[model samples]
Target: MIRLVKVSKSYGDTIAVRQLSLVVNQGEVCVLIGPSGCGKTTTLRMVNRLIEPTAGRIFINGKEISRVKPEQLRRSIGYAIQSVGLFPHMTVADNIAVVPELLHWAKSRVAHRIDELLRLVGLDPLEYASKYPNQLSGGEAQRIGVARALAANPPILLMDEPFGAVDPLTREKLQAQFLRIQQELKKTVLLVTHDLDEAIRLADRIAIMASGRLVQHATPEEILSRPTNKFVHDFVGTDRALKRLSRIGVASFIRPTHSVKLSTPMKEVASVCERCHWVWVVDDDGKFTGWLDRTSLPAANSVRQAMVVGDRDEITITKNATLREALSRMLGQGFNSIPVVDEEGRLIGEVSLGDVEAATAKMEP
Candidate 1:
């Protein structure tokens, strides 16, 4: 939905971006990533006219953006940054209400929008509404920044290092939340970051920049497996094979399997998984409880007694989890196979280390 055609920006003798051209498809995230000085942020800023391009044109949906007033353009396109840039003096509600209020939305409509946005970003509206920016945690503040950005329900979002300032754990949570939100909102997004892992995790397409020029722009799998040049290859790092796993969902590799019920006879459970190393055990409700080691099955009377509950929570991957996450869980917990569960924690399928092995092996150089 957004297109940049031969866009370039210069500062005196230096060029921030040079004849860069890219298209961010409708309802897809396009991440711009590179080294520190590679103009990823400059490209992002130019989209919202925060930094006017020295040359070339930007178009949104079919019309050129230059025709629109900067304030109007910004209001129509959501913008969030690394610094959060929230007004410290304003209450969280007032801060989120900034854009809607600017647009002269009705008082009732603005109030509803404020609460809706806060909830959408995982904050308690009633509790957080009166809290000022200074009163919030880093993660909470960033979420508020996002709520403020989405106050107007814009179809396009421009983010420049939006998750960079938060700690790694918080950053991961934010990224996952953004992915869920994106699935629901389907906004055309252009995000800038220096972290390749973040790009791999979040991007539908990646634009790699080098020394103020567009080096390569493609899907993460293509960029990882078929780098256009040495720079692109090196920039993506040596762990490209494992990185490709991040783009694949666990569902794609899940093998349909049976789970023994808690009331099932131990002998029956052993027979059911006679050829397997372990069998997943579920409760009467079919909710996953744990797994049973076949080797321990003969001496056990019930599924509960012999069930190997070795950090099952830590080793479990949701059906929607990336294969990389499954692999990481396995490696971290020394698991041969990890059970896949639905959102309700019911066993759906399982992914093995061999599953990831086979996937990467098929794509091997």
Candidate 2:
């Protein structure tokens, strides 16, 4: 939905961006990544005329941006940045309602959009709507910034290090939320980041820029497995194979495994054998609860009495989770396999370290 042809931005003698040409297709995220002075952010700003390009044509869905009014062009495109840029004086709902209200949407419609966008970003409208930006934590502000950008339901989104300001744990969560939101909303995105992990995790295509010019533009898989040049190779690093594993989902490797309901008699749990010395334990509704260590029989009636319970987030992974995450969890917990769950935490299957190993073996260069 965004097309830049030979785009160049210069300030006096120094050119911030030089003849950079790229295309971010409809409904896919295109990440612009490179080193500190590589002009990835400059490239993003040029898309919405935040920093006008000195040379080259910029287009949003085939209409040249230079031909459109700056305010109109920007309003039609969503913009998010590292600092979050939330207005401290404005309440969360009012902040999100900015663009929609600017468009003259009905007051009632604007209010509904506020709640809807807040929820979409995983925030409660009731608790957060009346809050000011100063009341929000860094992560909350980042989420609010995203909600505001998406407030108008723009087809194109420009994000400049959207998750860069947060801590690692919070960054991971924000990335996951962004992925889920993108899956549902399907907005075309052009994001700028220096993080290779973030690029691999989110980009459908990675446009690696250097010295204000496009160095390589390709799918993350191809970029990792086959670098176009020495610069691209070094930029991707020696752990290219490992990085590729992050792109594979846990669902692809899930295997059917034995499981028992929490209500099952301990005697029955002790008899059923998966040969792993443990059986997955779930509730009556089939939601994953814990595990039954068949190796140690307990003097109890039901599986719930004998089984070891675990934190849902800590012990189980969702179908969409990357194998890299699963592998990390397994190594951290010293387990060979991890349970895979659905959105409702229902046990689907398990993915083993062997599965992760087999996948990584092929990626070795």
Candidate 3:
């Protein structure tokens, strides 16, 4: 758990943060977001003593952070930034092992921790361990930065634009991976970003900042539908409903009952009927291939030939995709529904336009 009480930071005459108070609960992800120069990142740096508060107090698990040594405080709190900050001379394994090694972990323990962290961030230790930072791509280095931060298993994490350096597609993948890792590890997280979409997608609570002040703090649903002031409302934008969709995942609205395998006899595939008017098709490996029309398929034709098939990226939404993404696919392709697949393209479920509309209807005021 992390808490900041009346926190303020000033450099000469300029105020970086003013009376900014916020709390990040245990195992929760609290995102700080706003326009440029809004003090969101300043507030995060104050948490792990990267920036000393000019006046207020910061606490980590009930102990005041100022009372602890800076180095010690940092070691107990994982920090990742936009630039990645990996030491160019150090190999990937050595970089991840830094915190654990500093903690005096046994050589064997540190080695194991390094490998575990590399895999957690979606890299294979065998392939990446001996490589230097310069050998990695921007996205790969960002992942390594995250891996190093988690190397010590710190209960608290501070991320300042952690995904900001990567391309949009890679940024999305990193966000998805971070969400998955958070679900399993449950570390209390404070992430700073100027991106409203990222905040809505990854936060349990969003803290919106402006002019070095905390403008609003609430769940993404509340923030989207019930902005506290004019600044908050306009900052959230005119498309608040679309922003709300970022908080709803495809998994929540998935309809998994109407799928048939490529090997399924046409007679069996033709027998099923759903109001959506089509059934999803998958290979023997369960990888989603396409969809078949329920009304026209003949008992003699194989399921694959009669069904619509296109580029996987163009047609399918991943199980972790937001309802907004599902709706976009449906509207762009002019479909009543879209299939949801796993990372491997396996059919997991389908989400209809109705499902996304219902989710929007439930947004709070």
| Candidate of highest TM-score | 2
Across 256-364, the per-residue lDDT of candidate 2 in tens digits comes to 9889997776656767843568888899988988887765565667776778897788889988899889988899888899999999999999999999999988774
- Candidate 3 residue-wise lDDT, 165-238, digit = tens: 88887898899999999999999999999888999999999999998999999998898889999999999999
Best by lDDT: 2
lDDT of residue 312 for candidate 2: 84
* RMSD score of candidate 1 (Å): 2.6
Give the count of colliding residue pairs in each prediction: 0, 0, 0
Candidate 2: where are CA atoms >4 Å away? 298-306, 362-364
Candidate 1 residue lDDT tens string, 1-365:
99999999999999999999999999999999999999998999899888899999999998899998899899879999989999989999999998989999999999999888888988888899999989999899989888888889999999888888888868878998999899999999999987888999999999999989999999998999899999998888899889998888888789987689889987788788877877888878777787787888778888888887544467677887888889998898787788888878788888999999998998857
User: lDDT of model 2 at residue 148?
Assistant: 94
Comparing 2 with 3 on lDDT, the higher-scoring candidate is 2
C-alpha displacement of 171 in model 2, angstroms? Answer: 2.4
Q: What is each predicted model's overall lDDT from 0 to 1? A: 0.88, 0.90, 0.88
Clashing pairs in 2: none
- List where candidate 1 sits over 4 angstroms from the true fold: 124-127, 167-169, 258-275, 295-305, 310-313
